[model samples]
Target chain A: MFLPVSASLRQFARAVTADRLAGDELAGAITAENIRAGKPPAAAKADLFREFILKWREILDANSRPRPFSSAEYVRSLGPPPSEARLVLLLNDICGLSQRDIEYVLDPLSKPFAELLKEGRAVIARQREERKALIVEDEPLIAADLKDVLENMGVTVVGLARTADQGAREALKSAPDIVLADYNLDGQKTGVDAVIAFQDSHQCPVIFITGYPDDVLKGEDVEPDFVIVKPYRPEAVQAAVAHCLDTERFFAIDADSANGDL
Target chain B: MSNEKSSAPEKRVEKLQIMVADSELAMIDDWRFENRAASRSAAIRSLIYLGLELTKSDPDAAAKLLDQLDRA
Candidate 1:
């Protein structure tokens, strides 16, 4: 996603510390080359382009975009050039950092965000457990992980289905709290189809996660709480699940409460 | 401004840091690539906004709204 500020704020940053900006030639090179390549180029934010600022910009860009991992591994093969700026915000702009980037930065096993997600779940869980929770996954291991994670957070995994048919059957039976469906399943039917099928039986949120992002993830019928990418840190997964569950609670509380359970 | 920065409530919702994944997030170089269409994050954000909008006037009627949207 593009930032709120100037798109080419790269050069001004490096010039601040390096005591020298890349000069006109280098500035043109960076911006011109990027533009030539169909990528966004650096632009100064008005007078913010003091010499030092330009230096820092380059450095910031380097640190922020730190050469994107070259593949789907999402694992950074090299460390970034050292700098003392708040980098996470910049990392947010990093397009190809592996699924592990956030996890690596914040240990899901022990980070504050992890704790927050857990706490977040409890907040909603303590409320009424009105909706049935559904888990649709073909991978037994990941399914077990979700079940464990949800159960640990005190949100029931009402039912588990390995295929669209099985998930749809469960949906018909329980009408689920939310469906945590893997985007691509083992059978011919996809998570989108599963969501449509399940919704046909009942209305519930679907939270999907995938390793690859493509057209398959679309469809107006599915209002997923979070579409986590695959290789997501445990904390990220927990956070997404927590959100959909919470949405259900909020949805239930609407004054006219649909099921009259609100 | 300081207090605004300090006391300004974090946008974080409990348990869920965010509802959706990036609509465009997928594997680019190695990081998640966010697609142009409905990434999970994008969907979540939209859903949250939609949820807030719907619940404001008629929460119980949300199902009907969703139903309407589904039909629309």
Candidate 2:
């Protein structure tokens, strides 16, 4: 199999097992078996994947021995255990498999493949819809407005702060999934400083609502991915928040993929 | 042989040069072997195609993934 295909398989295994070590062992065993079989280089990928599904229960049972860590630890770090529908989505969306390939791999489905995929997307969308944000704008009015906007979009506003110090304290109290901060705060430290501090303990997406985009962009300290210029519309904030959440999810997956050997 | 030569017109002719760190090179080599690409060049082209398609679909996610890959 190609490197991408192998990587995809590894990722799929990881998602299904929700344990890095187990996923590595499972994929390694399957790949070794395939090599021993002396399958042709052009062997069908779908067949290999189907074999993975067929062997999952046996392999998982074999590897269920006690380890240094608990499965709950792994589940907490990653998201919840993936359902079959989510597994299909991960294969097609994250693993880059074609729909036809998935259909072949998951043959004899109770429901149509399209329906399962739609359900998967809906589950993912609902998860994304529920998010938490920390707003750090010095102006009371602006901070309230930001909170209202996020709440309207179904994101829980965790905290509102007028200075970098307050923001850091709030973040320590309750870790936020995302942060929206104004460039100039009530104290000497700018939003960039506050973001850096927040990230020191917890890493999350930061959207800088700054009047001077140039200052934030040119600042050597922190380079934020999402920045809304001052006098921004509600739509702009909403769009930035949505994009940041999506990017954060992708980062989480990438980090999980890189944690262990394939 | 005649059919192969006839298809040569569609073959890639342009050249590009770039540099990568040892770790990155190792990843490329691993990818090349896994995909069974004919050469490093072929593997790199395929990677580029994949990256472009991802970027087209979700620019933010693609950019973040690229950044992670660079750090990896």
Candidate 3:
């Protein structure tokens, strides 16, 4: 496969599986299997994605338990589990595949692509409209700025904490849809410590907006998927928040399945 | 004097086959009728061209679509 096509497939698989490792592994396995089978190279982008969808379905079937998958049992507050069609729509947003290409890949779709797109949009809009965020920054100006940006995106700022301890306390008091934390705090505990404190209970997405991205990335305690460096663009923040919110539910589902709690 | 005109040579267009659901076909037919397109091929061509034009104008069309979705 071509480099760009391979990368896009990896991304699409990641969005579908909601686990980076699983998604990458699945993509690699499929590519290797195709090569071993001596199949011709995919003639169109849709062909490659169709192969991925088959592999994903096989995994889902293998992992099927006696009890049917239910989102209510695990996290009722997060709303319903994302349907497969919704995930496809989300994948389109991430991969930027054309409508015709997507239709080809997900042929016999339970719902029309246009209708699914509309429904997915409404769901996302509602989620954003009611979304709440917690900002952990010692700098008063930065915290205020984050609040304003999130508010403009329709995300309510639940609380602002100057220290890790306070951040954790605020998070516990009111659960946030996502958390934006700075690396260094006013107190002994860095933002990493603060995130570690509540992440187990909360399981919300974390975006580290800090000058010391290296320190945060190299930390042994927690590994965040989204990190923005200092002097960030508001557009960057908005994009991160949108992506984090979009994938949070899917991640929760994956976690539940891993723990056999689903 | 002979009248002569110069222009780029026409390129050969290959025929590509695709599968569409019944609903999608109906959508195409509806669009063709509404726009008074000459044929299904014409309607499909116009739609594809429109989509390509939009993408060219705004590479972030998907992101913008998401924003629109949020509003919708």
Candidate 4:
């Protein structure tokens, strides 16, 4: 109920601000402030809650300790700053904020807030799906082609890692969603080795595109998530990535569908 | 059902203990959070699975890989 939410919010407010306002005192102050601002109680509460979360996140980020996966923390972890409407959905969905509590806190805006949640979800989903990829291909022409292909698929090419070591460095720095690596890189360390090195700390899906299948097969490092034979169609690259992200059962189904169409 | 009979199958696994620097540990923790995995173990397992799945071309690829790894 609102009791838990109110208590938690007050506790967080005290922790962050180091101000101790009694429970009713804080609520009364917030209500008075909302009235002065010419905003409805519900909307004001929602806004206040969002602001509190943002402030708390900043405080948490400044500290050395690991952040908790609480409501606000989870929202902050979603890569980019979420929209107000999206925050509402996260509060409702992830935080288990009930309609009554939302009404009490967010007020009359509760119904409309719920309505706007779907649109916000689509926006956030699109942003989340804007998968960033690091291309570790040595060939300039091939790297450009890969970048174009990935961009066309709505993936952002963070950078092209020409050598295995550079690829590892870029991947560590950017923390890309996926890696597109060529088996034979420019340096002594193969693309497979580079991806393995990246995986030692950061875990991102990788798709290996290479002409020398045996080179990868013979490698001692861990294997990539998916391998596409060279001279591949652009569509094949898209399908391979989709397959990895899709449900495990759906992957075979998707492959079957692709084959059926062919 | 009795506790033993109803219990999950015992997984035969080797514990991999590695010494990582503070920075490296932070990186792993960050990766785990970003991936939305339940735990560090789950994150590592998912990563290994993804790698294995990508490299595997056939059903018996795992056995072949083990053989190759052993020989190497």
For every model shown, what is its TM-score relative to the native structure?
0.42, 0.40, 0.44, 0.37
Candidate 4: CAPRI quality band: incorrect
Candidate 2 B-chain TM-score = 0.68
Ranking 1 against 4 by TM-score, winner: 1
Q: Among these predicted structures, which one has the highest TM-score?
A: 3
Interface RMSD of each: 18.0, 21.2, 28.3, 21.5
Q: Over 4 Å off in model 1, which ranges?
A: A1-131, A215-223, A248-255, A258-262, B1-72
Model 2 lDDT tens row, B1-72: 111222322211122357899999999989978975434655676687777778999999999987997998
Q: Kindly list the per-residue Cα lDDT of model 2 for residues A149-252, writing each as its tens digit.
A: 78767788989989998888887777887899898886689887787787767767677787765454331336554556667667556655654554213223
Q: Give the Cα lDDT of each candidate.
A: 0.46, 0.62, 0.63, 0.54
lDDT of 1 by residue, A145-174 (tens): 888767766677788899988888888898
Error of 1 at A167 (Å): 0.6
3 versus 4: better TM-score goes to: 3
lDDT of 1 at A233: 56
Model 2 ranges with Cα > 4 A deviation? A1-129, A248-254, A257-262, B1-72
Ranked by lDDT, the better of candidates 1 and 3 is: 3
User: Which candidate has the top score in lDDT?
Assistant: 3
Each candidate's fnat, listed in order, reads: 0.00, 0.00, 0.00, 0.00
